[model samples]
Target chain A: MAIDERMEGIEAVFLDLDGTIYLGGELIEGASEFLDRLDHRGVKRFFLSNNSSRSVSQYLRKLTRLGIPAREEEVLLSTHDLLNWLEAEGIDDTFLVGTQGMGEMLEARGIRTQSKSPQAVVLGYDTEITYQKLSDASMYLHAGVPLVASHPDLVCPSPVGGLPDVGAYLSLFETTTGVRPVKVCGKPNPSMILGMIGELGLDVECCAMIGDSIYTDMAMADASGVHGILVLSGEATAEDAATSNVRMSLIAPSVDSLCR
Target chain B: MAIDERMEGIEAVFLDLDGTIYLGGELIEGASEFLDRLDHRGVKRFFLSNNSSRSVSQYLRKLTRLGIPAREEEVLLSTHDLLNWLEAEGIDDTFLVGTQGMGEMLEARGIRTQSKSPQAVVLGYDTEITYQKLSDASMYLHAGVPLVASHPDLVCPSPVGGLPDVGAYLSLFETTTGVRPVKVCGKPNPSMILGMIGELGLDVECCAMIGDSIYTDMAMADASGVHGILVLSGEATAEDAATSNVRMSLIAPSVDSLCR
Candidate 1:
């Protein structure tokens, strides 16, 4: 299918937030117009973010404040996937090294964020990471406890540049304890969006995965059998997408131009 | 030359400490006997260790406590190499993430170990590492300061198992900043032993590098034209040496068997 033609069949869209809709605190140009176009076309759209530092409520507030009003059901996070994974594995106790907001999300799900005898060590994008957390996690890992991470993004896109993310934290653990994460739940792991897609009664063929990062967004689309759409409004350049093996169904300059 | 034949011309020995001489607090079986044999043979022996958390005086104290009877001049440490490298580069200002003992050594050398405007981030086997140290190191690395590590040993051997070392800390910094060390001064670097060899007016071919690790001791030997001797009392098994690419000139059951 042609780049523009692929959009015709996309009845539902999974949109990445940070790079696609906004970069840091400022909203991207044409993002609102693109969302309006999706609304006009009766396309079901959902906001997906791999940043586990913020909870769903925080994301809702941020989105609303940015003029892109999002309901609770319409926003999905890696934290949700982490919660689901923990529940399925019967993991009620974990030593979590994440933000206060992330702590609340885990606690609300009945997962103890700080257990002395934790079954596993759960890692996230912890901007508030401390030495105690790192030391404790290393001790648990050395004791043969499994590790679970929220995502595998090496760096998060920022206005200044890339900032360390969960992937970097995972590397630290690996070097310290010679242990790797048993599970990483987020973008590039198809289950992040597959559950929501199933719940929406959406056909996989008519669903498009859209984002700025080729590795996470496009790779997830490939894994989940959704139409991968690459937006150049963020981290990845056209040259990057061209050289990458990921087959993007559509390559747009931005969501606005694609929608227009 | 045959494995035993290579030892015939050896006039001096460069011995690794942790696995070769002592395992934690206790000396390895026959370690004393091995040293006595080398002493009887009129061979000069130097203790070469990649463990940089301890200074030379601390190592001398530990050696004397263990009944090894080591002199200050007979001790060669990764810290010595780090100091030499710093001096060569004329770097007096560094952000050091190491032990208090290591801090004292750098300070004595007229090097600022805790400068806000550091020329480099110097890493060592810091058992007393704090989160503040790690966070500060990451910030400096992100700000484009070059990283210089004392050694590249991932884990230090302990009585029970392995403990995190400078290499582990280096991994953490790499993940957080996407930066690797500009220089790593320690075993297998050749310069660690080469300088002493030149000072002693000893031929490299007449010296034997004996240790338990093939990657460090034997690899250093290969790089500096010294006879490589492998002991089976530490990290590498006989099976491992059999499959490895590093060519060892001799293999022994332990330092005892090699000396005898």
Candidate 2:
């Protein structure tokens, strides 16, 4: 099938939150209309996000607050994605260096969390960091624990300013222990996209990834052989899309243009 | 007096242990004869070592086993040197990353050991290391803690092979924390030698340094404007001394030859 024909046959759609479907607490104009069109067409849809600061249920609640109907199962978060990957990889326990939300998520997935002699070190967005915690994590790394990071971003921009992210911690550990992380399970990596595709049982070529971050969203599409749509509602501007290595299949001012 | 005249006047001498006196538990042949000659001259002498792996009492025991007479105050260890320097600098409390020997030495000198919110990081040769210790040190560095390293040897040779020394750890931490040590108080730097000179109340030109390692012992003499005697008893071979950057005032097969 031709690229556009494959896109036309897309049985499932994966949407990125924050910059794609909504910004802050407001949905982009016509996001509901686009979802309604997908519903009418009988397409399976889900929202996959790299943000680990919030849980899937929290995202669902936010969607509800924004008048977008989202089921609990249809929202896949990085924390959940990591848990799934760990379970599939036969990792039943991990030394977690993240927030309580991530700890809860890991425990919910039947993974035991321990500070001593852990099989792997899982890093998420942690705001409550301490010197003791950093030392304990470094000890685990020095003792040769496998490392898995949720995302590769060095900084995450918030309402106030940019804060140190997973990449910053990774750099510190790498410098001290001379060991870099073996794998990352979010964003620009195609493994997460492929997992989403498998979970949704979608035809790969027809699926489109629409988001504001070209590095992650478009890169994921390019790597997974899916159509990429760049939207100007969030992080990336039109100029960023033009200079980006991942070519966009379509450009829309907002989700409103998709249905029109 | 001229350096040559001072060299002629020297009757007794002090020597550094590791890298200077002997390496890896083996006595430098002719070292015993050198000491015997110094004894015959009724020269006041002692041995100084910066290695903190063992206590002064332990060093005395080791020296006794090796057929060298050692008294408590006669053997000036790195711990002693550091304590003296700390007292002279008026630093009562310091964050030290070293062994029990270092801790004992600091305590004996009335210097307090504080790891958290440390005023400065005083590094020594620590045999026992953990990731937590390194992480804590990094945190202190990030918080703008002044770094003071005991020595600058990248690796210290052991009976089995070589281990990363203080310099290696400093290199790794500097890469991550963007802070290098402010001062190194060991051989090849003039401060330690000059300090020793001040303690002995000897003129710089009148003092002579005799040791096996050309890079450290000879270079120290060169830097301090003192006469240096290179002995073939420890780390450096005769070939190394010939090609080394350190210029020597005298070459001796052993301390016995120096007396001749």
Candidate 3:
């Protein structure tokens, strides 16, 4: 609630990677120090990203390269939520439109990602998309196969700018077959950090969700009853936060300014 | 615009082929007879389509095979409008994400369809879409190249069902690049039929646009000052027409019932 008391009871910080801590390969100024402060203060920090294009390992590698040092457990991707949903639905067969790394993750879980006769069509942030994949996915969807997407993000932030993400593809599918995704797994859905918070034995009230996106990060925090700290290092500007329906618990220039 | 005066003062008919004359390979019931009536009555008929996947020659051949006896001049494709727009804008180089037929049409018009460096991104209903084409288009759009689509039909009606069309691809591009088409050369835009009417020296009020889709066919008629005749053999239904904003001049189960 209060600005100064925002992080008063917080024990864990669910930090958004792209906009909160860094943009592209470069870390924001003071982000390293902010993370160091979290470490020193005994606050558990986990990277949360709605971007499903990159796998957990890739995120870890990127974080390490950027000197943000992260472990596999400290990285949370939308793919994990997708896997959880797939397992829960008892859907072992799927026609996945995702990257090779994502395929590997699904295959590791005994889920066949390229079944000829799939029960569902699982769409992710498929950057390496082909006409064949799109056509096949459309064919299946037209045949009444339910659709599940990794996330609802219309665009993924890149150095070049926002690229069409799974959300855009979903719109394409909707236009083509008049079918929409039955479920979308990612931030703003609450379950994203909620599951992690429960497993880590952290109080929901004491868990702060820090990110630049007000819709996803702040919305998730507000929905899940977690402290939402809006960062201005990325997409959401102060003007955006002022007009947004999803109210942020605290606002910081960037994670670099937090715990300073 | 009364039901009995539907075709009373009509001197020409701008008919939509896919839904009005035929569905996929099979001709609609009484379609040939309806065309015969139009010919017998000396009403000039031109087949209109928003589908740019096929060239004029391809459409003529298909119509011939389907026993529609269509000549080259009788077919008015969205591709024609696309060429008109491109030529008017003095564009000679383009990156086209379309079928071979559409590419051939563009190339014949002295427009380079596949230049490494393009002035514009011309999108069509590409059934033979590839990952490379999409990626290249995305790259160009990201570089701030304007996008021009052939048409905005979400799905192409097929024997199997609805297939992904230009509208679907447009959504993908919009999602990926946040750039919408600067120009869409198809129905609902009065210019689509207005130009043809001007060329043919036909009175716009004396011409009728007959098709199934209310959004495209009827809306085009309403916008272009042509009598709008709706056929229920394809997309629009009686219930749809009843609730739609576009005022229909006449409603029939098929074109067969219109002149009868």
Candidate 4:
């Protein structure tokens, strides 16, 4: 089925960045046009990224630079979900392994990120991670402190093969201390976008999840009772989608074919 | 049975450091006296440690400072076993995650410790580990480079609980890239002390391994055909050895009771 036909009753569509919108620094072909189509059809589109390295301001700048009209409100990140979960769990003190961009975001929300007696260790996509962070985190884990990850991505796709992400770090921590994270926030957790779906008064039947990853995007859609549109312009191929047990409501080469 | 009774026909005894000889900065009670007893009995005593943080010279200095007369030749380390394995496997150029002491040891053996394109990544019990080393190793692993570990001890027993060691680092690497070491060359591998047993022309039956860790010391003894003496001075408790399937020739509170 064509994405236009499948997208008929969908009022809000969640979009994944990186492989879904762009690969590396270059924008995906027709990604901007796809946004324009969503706007023309009076359909709401929200950009969702599991990458915790950048803050909303950084993402807004990147999207603006890419010839895409995106507001701060239209962008959602895994960091936001993590922060929410942290607040919900009443955790104010934490030892964090993340970039300054992510640190600023956490600090702004009243969380002590470098606590000596932290309640938990917050892990993120730390491009500027240090040896000190890994060792400190390992020591804390050895001492029985729980860990929380922003996302579960093993590797972030790059022009090169890929780079180790939170998932990889989580594996390392689990390996070192035989301890796994108590909670992992972000995509496929249902609450990442489902809370917003409820706030917008959108019925589950009128919501759609569009992304490249079946495990994260499609899986979230499945859990949240929303339609899942799998895009194959990223890490996953058509063969992977077909072979996977995940249910993808519609499959398109890219958003380029959507509504055409 | 008393360790002295079990030691009747033993020609040589491999004594594990840390819990067996000493703990942290202090020497274990009766440890030096046990060495004196070995000397009086005309038995050879070799000091063995899986700690990769300290070189043989360092170990000699530590033992000497602790008032135990130990020669450089009397010390055997996991790094030595790892170096032997690397040489046997023809792995020269490699990236290393270890302290300067370990790096110098590898370099002295004509192995490059920071090669970008290398045969393997060497994991050790590095006290001065950094994030750059970890990320670089992860990248190498992502590219399918093999990893080699010095030993499999998860924690270096410290006065305050314990610190993460090569085993922990190995776990981290295994978690990050889903790649375990092609070979871990220490302790239970048996090659650590077995080669020395051969060089000494001592029969395995006449050899004894004395350590507090059953997994490494006792396991190695089992594989190398030596008597395993379980000591309750370090990581293992009386109950741990009691519940374990590992066989022990004798169990002592500490090396304090040895040769009495």
Candidate 5:
């Protein structure tokens, strides 16, 4: 399908949830209004996040609780993208250093989890990190298992300052094994964005990415050759956005200001 | 105190522990015999390890268990060195991202541990790393806290391969906080070797760095204009040692073969 120049002409709008639509459990002011405008325009909207801490179903439920109606299929989480990628590669047995959500995601794809001889090492936002787990992951990496990181964020902003996420584990693995990850499949990576665009069969030229973090959201736009709109309702300020390589085409205070 | 070239002229022998005496838990072959020979030679041997996971007392205990006669005062651990250095600098409050051993060592030196308003950041080999610890350290580093790393071994050799040590943490802090450590007070850092040489009242030319790891032990010798004797008892193999920039004066099977 041919893509149009304006955002209204686009078939899909992929949104970053945390720090973009909401902070913590509260929605950003005007986020619901922005969604209502999208609904009125009959444009498809998808909530995408790199956080593998929760499932897409959970994200959908959260959005509903915030008075924004979102279906299960409309939300794309990192775990969902990872499982889809793994299935496409025809992989079965793997070692996971992440949450139970990741384990469930892999199991749902009919992939067997093996600690001893895992074909690949999947890293996610794991809260239950033990020394044994770290040792096993390091061993797997040293044995030349393909390393895949869920995201590249070093820290995730919390209500209190910042928290170490998947990137912390990734750093440890890199240090111990002297091996950097081969692939990172998340919001910032173009492959994930292209996959999302492919589902809608939309032309890349007309799409616009809206999010709070310029590093990920705007970079995704630049990578996909699309326009990016950065909203200052979340993590990044306008000054922070200005310093990025990805030029912001539209500047809005929040998602609510986008419709006007 | 005029330092002489003869082995008998040496009063105190500063020895690197990791590669020279042992690799991980198991003692290097003939290492105990080498210590026995030192006793016969009337040389006061001090076991020095850049590893900050344990204290001097702990090292002494471990060495005593391994059949090497050692006292807590004769063991120089990195944390002990750091605490001494901090005290000399007149710094009382510090933020430490290390083990309980390191914390205890610093506390013994009267340096208060501050998570928020730390005057300096003392990094050590913390086996039990948490996201909160890394986050706090990064913040302190970003705030321009004077950074001092205990050592520079990116990976510590373990029974199960290698694990990320203090150097790895320094790297992570560098990447996240955009600040490189100003000082690394461990082997190969010049300052550490010089400090030990001064304590022994030995000239740099008369001193010899006898250890296993070429990067740390031999590199320290090369940098400080001292003799570097490589032992094949730890981390680096003979082949790996051959290609290093550090001059390998004597390639012995163990420290026992050093003065034979």
Candidate 6:
């Protein structure tokens, strides 16, 4: 089917950040134009990312600098997904093992970032991870303190190589204390986009998920009952989409090809 | 049988450190007197340990500081066993993930403690563990550098509680990269004492292993065909030994009650 034909009745687009709109500091060519086209089509676009290392404000600053029009409300993150889960569970105090940025984000949302006696241990992609943080959190787990992870990504892409992420840390904690996370909130959970679609009273079919990763972005799109658009601009290639069992509504070189 | 009855044929005694001779910074009650008794009984004593964090010199210092006379030659360590394995396997260069003392122990014995291109990644009980060390060693392992650990101890006993040790670290690396140590050298392997017994030209039945831990000390004795003495001055209790399937020659409140 043609791109426009596949995109026909979609009222909203949930877009991934890294590799989708921008790769590192440079924006993907025609990404801003694609966002402009979404506006012209009266389509609501939400910037979604699994990077819990950065708060919404930091993401907003980066998006603005990259020339992508976005607001705080227009951003969806694994952190927000975590906050929603914690809120539902009636937890306000936690021992967080994450970056300073992540701690600030949780504290700003009224969750105590550091509690002497915590109800749970909140984990994220802590780029600034330390041994003490690991030991402290492991001890907590040994003492039966619950663990909640923002994402299950094993490694983050670095210029040098893949660096250990929360998934690796989770493995460490489980190994040390014989305990695994009680809940992991992030992409592939589908709640991040599905909750938003529900709030907007939009049918899931009226929305489409666009990103480079088949495991996360397309997987979430599939579970949320939304249109899945696999793009080759990021980690995945056209060959990957062709070989994968993941159902895709469209396979484009980038968002540049969509809403054209 | 009486205490001396159990001690009848033993010409040498191997002892565990952390729980047998001392706990934390203080020597166990009657421990020094027990050493004196062993000397009077004409029984040779060797201080054995799975604690690779402390070099033999450090252990000597701690023992001397505690007023228990010990010679450098009388100390046996899991590090020695690891070094023995590395020597036999012809691996001289390694990326060491351990404390400064452990590094010195390996480096002084002709092993390169830090190599850009290492033959293996040697792990120990790294009390001063860092994220950089974990990441660097993990990357090396990911690049196919085999891992060798000093011991398989899950936790090191402390005044407060058990602390995560090399066993936990092994699990972490395994979960992170699907890599396990090619060999774990320490107690219960029997090599730590069996090698010494062979060198000394002594029969295994003429030796006795005494310690507070049933797993390492008693298990080593069972594997090496030596008499097993379970002491209650450390981690294990008489009741634990009673219920445990580990065969023991004797169970005493402390080492002081032995060899009398």
Give all candidates' CA lDDT scores.
0.86, 0.71, 0.86, 0.86, 0.74, 0.85
Residue range A1-260, candidate 1, lDDT tens digits: 34473278678999999889998888999889888989999989999999998989999999999999888989889988889999999999899988889999999989999998898899988877765677777888888889999988877765434566888777777887889999999988899889988898887888998899999999999899988889998889999998999978888888878655
List each candidate's DockQ score: 0.23, 0.05, 0.42, 0.29, 0.30, 0.32
Instruction: Tell me the number of clashing residue pairs for each predicted model.
Output: 0, 0, 1, 2, 0, 0
Candidate 2 per-residue C-alpha lDDT over A66-117 given as tens digits, one digit per residue, 9 for 90 to 100: 8887888787777766876788789987888787777777887788766466
CAPRI-wise, candidate 5 is acceptable
Model 6 CAPRI rating = acceptable
Report the C-alpha lDDT of model 5 over A1-260, residue by residue, as the tens digit: 23222355655678888888999999888788778888888878878899987766667778889998778778777777678777777768788887776777778778875557787888888765555567677778888899887788877776544566777667767777888887777878777677778867878865677888888888887788766778788888878877777766776777776754
What is the Cα-based TM-score of model 2? Answer: 0.57
lDDT of 6 by residue, A1-260 (tens): 22353377889999998889998898988888888888999999999988898988899999888777578899999999999999999999999988888899889889997887889999998877665776777777777889999987777655434567788777767767778899999998988888889889998878999999998899888888899888888888878887888777888888887786
TM-score of chain A considered alone, across all candidate predictions: 0.96, 0.89, 0.96, 0.96, 0.91, 0.95
How well does model 5 score by local distance difference test? Answer: 0.74
Better of 1 and 3 by DockQ: 3
* Native contacts recovered, each model: 0.31, 0.00, 0.61, 0.27, 0.31, 0.25
- Please provide, for model 4 over A108-203, each residue's C-alpha lDDT reduced to its tens digit, 9 standing for 90 to 100: 999989999999999999888665787788888888899999999887765534567888777667766778899999998888998889889998
Candidate 6 scores a chain A TM-score of: 0.95
Candidate scoring better on DockQ of 3 and 5: 3
Candidate number with greatest DockQ: 3
- Model 6 residue B196 CA deviation in Å: 3.0
Model 2 reproduces a share of the real contacts of 0.00
Select the stronger candidate by TM-score from 2 and 4: 4
My TM-score estimates for the predictions, one after another, are: 0.74, 0.57, 0.77, 0.88, 0.86, 0.87
- Can you tell me the CAPRI class of model 2? incorrect
Q: What local lDDT does model 4 show for residue A233?
A: 93
What docking grade applies to model 3? acceptable
Q: Can you list the residue pairs that collide in candidate 4? A: A131-B130, A131-B131
TM-score rank, highest first? 4, 6, 5, 3, 1, 2
> Residue B60 error for model 2, in Å?
2.1
Error of 3 at B15 (Å): 4.2
Q: Which ranges in model 4 have alpha carbons more than 4 Å from their true place?
A: A1-11, A36-43, A64-69, A127-135, A138-144, A158-162, B1-11, B36-43, B64-69, B126-132, B158-163
lDDT at residue B124 of model 6 (Cα atoms): 96
What is model 3's interface RMSD?
2.2
